[model samples]
Target: MTTICVDAMGGDERPEVVLEGIAAALAADPELEVLVAGDEGVVGPFAESHERARALVTTEVIGMGEHPAEAVRAKRDSSIVRGCAAVRAGEADGFFSAGSTGAIFTAATLGVGRIRGIRRPALATALPGLDGHRTIALDLGANADARPEMLVQFAHMGRAYAKVVLGVEDARVGLLSNGTEDAKGSELAVSYHEALAAAGCGFAGNAEGTDLLLGSFDVIVCDGFTGNVALKSMEGTAKYLVKQIKAAAGESKRSAVGALLFKPALKRVAAELSGDEYGGAVLLGLKAPVFIGHGATSATAVAKGTAACAAAVRGGLVDGIAQALADAS
Candidate 1:
């Protein structure tokens, strides 16, 4: 069984809701082993409720609201640090956290280290696009600003992730830009356009924000600042669409009844579009699989995130990414 270490104290909901989600996930998959790293006092009781919760999961509490770097260094009991340590020590295959992203990123870098030749890691989030496939945007807050070479490296990492995680073979990659023309974006885009093209990463030229969800490419590459904005925009748009649909249905009794009749189908569609369904973002360019769950992620999200991490580890995504980067270099 692949062991996944979860930082139980990281999210806003902490041990309670996160525990509830873990219960739900374990109930769904009995064979999965989870290590809940958080306050044992809080997590212990919660684990006793389920038959296999205690048997399958072990609790190791870490302090909350502490400086991640200092905490990781000083507090050997801290959850995030211990969780990463477990993975590094071969006790677990992956680490999932909904806590402090900065701390989690920092801990992963310091404790787990990056793959060979990977300068810095990038956060890759999947966004729903045209057809059935998702478009992945990299550097989604990993590096605030990236050099032209870094952006080029992100493109390679993004392409490999799409192929392994999303099962896309010839992943199309586009540089985020203001216009479709090659000269549309910043000097970075202009500088890296030929680099991406020269690297032969199935380059799809420049893509605009308007075309982001229109399925312009399988992967989109940009610095974290722009990528984070684009990701938040997509998430906000999805939420607004759902709210609008709910409002439209409640406007009339007839519509309400219609919605009730199609509630299950609508819910299924909504769940698929929900950001949590994709199980947060993966910090690519690392030596081991690392998933950054949303701070407000539901138990379903945690469960799904665990599954995603397991798949990534089993697929050797880390080594594959390292090899891709080496080939690009």
Candidate 2:
């Protein structure tokens, strides 16, 4: 059985949303077990009622704005730290949190530790692709600055993740650049492009920002600074478009009627573009599977995110990445 340690006190909402999501996740997977880490007074009762759920009482909680490394060290008994410690202790196969991204990354790196030979860990998310397949993008916000060698490692790691978690065979990888030509982008992009091509890991050359949703490549690698900017921009644009569509739909009686007629299609489109549908971002290059969800994540998103983490563990994601890196070396 695969067990995942969950941070019951993490996220904007407290133990309530976390417990409800855990119940939903447990109901969905019969063989799964959960270890809830938070204050015993809150999470203990809820965990007791569930069959396969257990609670590990933690006294402290990590604030979202705290310095990641400092908080991890100072608050050793914090929910985030304890949850990661569970994985390191072999009590859980993975860890899931909708808490501070920086804190979680720090805890995971220090507690469960990084895979041998990995310079840094990356946060990868599945983006909706035009080809009916999800494209994997990495270094979402793990490191604001990265070297060309790190980007090359990101490509290999992203390829392994796509194959294992997304079930894509021979995933194509591309360097995210200003243009498709090798001459475009900064010096880092140029160096990465040449290195990846020589590495021969299904290099698809360079891809522009427009290619992200076009499914032109199965995996795209870039420095965290560029990747994070692109991610937030797309998210903001999606929200703006949705709002505009809703407003237009209610502009007039005739439009309302038209919207009613196409409500089903519109709902489908909304789900397709929703962040919850894809769960949360996966933290790659760790010793175990770890997923970080949005801070304001809903109960449904939590359930889906936990399920995604479980799937990653079952799919041998860590082993796959280790093997890929070994082969590349």
Candidate 3:
């Protein structure tokens, strides 16, 4: 049986929402087992109620505002740390946490460790394109300022994500830039473009910001600072456009009728744009699969994230990365 260790007290919503989500996940997958990690007072009852769950009883919690490295080192018994330790100790096949991104990264990297040759582990997620194709983007917030060589490594890892997770063989890779031309970017992008082409890791030309949703490339590579900015901008724009459309439609009876006619389609669009669709981002280059969800996650999102972690375990995501890096070397 595949088991996933969950941080039941990690997110802003805490134990209640986490427990509800876990119930949904357990009901959906009979073969799946959960090892709940949190304070005994918070996680005890839930574990008692569910036959498939076992509580780890962590005493500490890493706050959203705490420094990642410091919190991880200081709070050895934090839910985040213990969860990662569970994965490393073979108690769980994978892990899921809707916790502080920084804490999750620090704990997972230090506790579970990275693949032997990987210089840096990146956060990779599949964002849906306008054409309904999903493109894998890396360093979503892992390393704010990465070196050129790190971007090259991100390219390799991102390709593995697309191939195994998204089922895209021979996925094309691109450097995120201001223009499609190889010469039209900052020093980092320029260096990445030249190095990626030489590395022969499915190098496509440079990708403009629009290419992220336009499906112009199968994988878009960037430093965490730039990628986080671009991702937030896209998210804000989508929210703004939807709000405007709904407001305009509600202003008149005729428009309301039109909105009623397209309500289902609108919901489909919203779900597609929501980052919760695929659960959360995967911390690539680690020894095992560890998914990091949004701070404000819903029960549905938690369930989806749990399923995703299980999928990664069954899909051999870590083994796939090791083999890919070996082949590249």
Give the top-scoring candidate (TM-score). Answer: 2
lDDT by residue for model 1 (1-329), tens:
66777777777765677777677767777666677777767667766766545322334433346666776666566677777878888877888888777778878987778888888899987877667768888888878888777877888888888888888877899988888897777777688676777777778899888766675688988889888888788778878988898999989999999988988998777777666788788898877888988877788888888778878887888878887877766
Report the lDDT tens digits of candidate 2 across residue range 1-329. Answer: 88999888889986789888989999999989999899989778978799999888999999888999999999999999999999999999999999999999999999899999899999899888765877899889899999877887898899999998779988999889999887887887888888888887878889888878885789999989889999998888888987888899899999999988988987777666665677789899999999988888778878888888899999999999998899999
lDDT, candidates in the order shown: 0.78, 0.88, 0.88
Consecutive 10-residue window with the lowest summed lDDT within model 1: 54-63
Clashing pairs in 2: none
TM-score of predicted model 1?
0.87
Runs in model 3 with CA error above 4 Å?
Answer: none
For model 1, how big is the CA root-mean-square deviation? 3.1
Q: How well is each residue in 179-245 modelled by candidate 3, as lDDT tens digits?
A: 9887988877788788888887888889888888886689999999988998889889988988999
| lDDT over C-alpha atoms for residue 246 of model 1 | 90
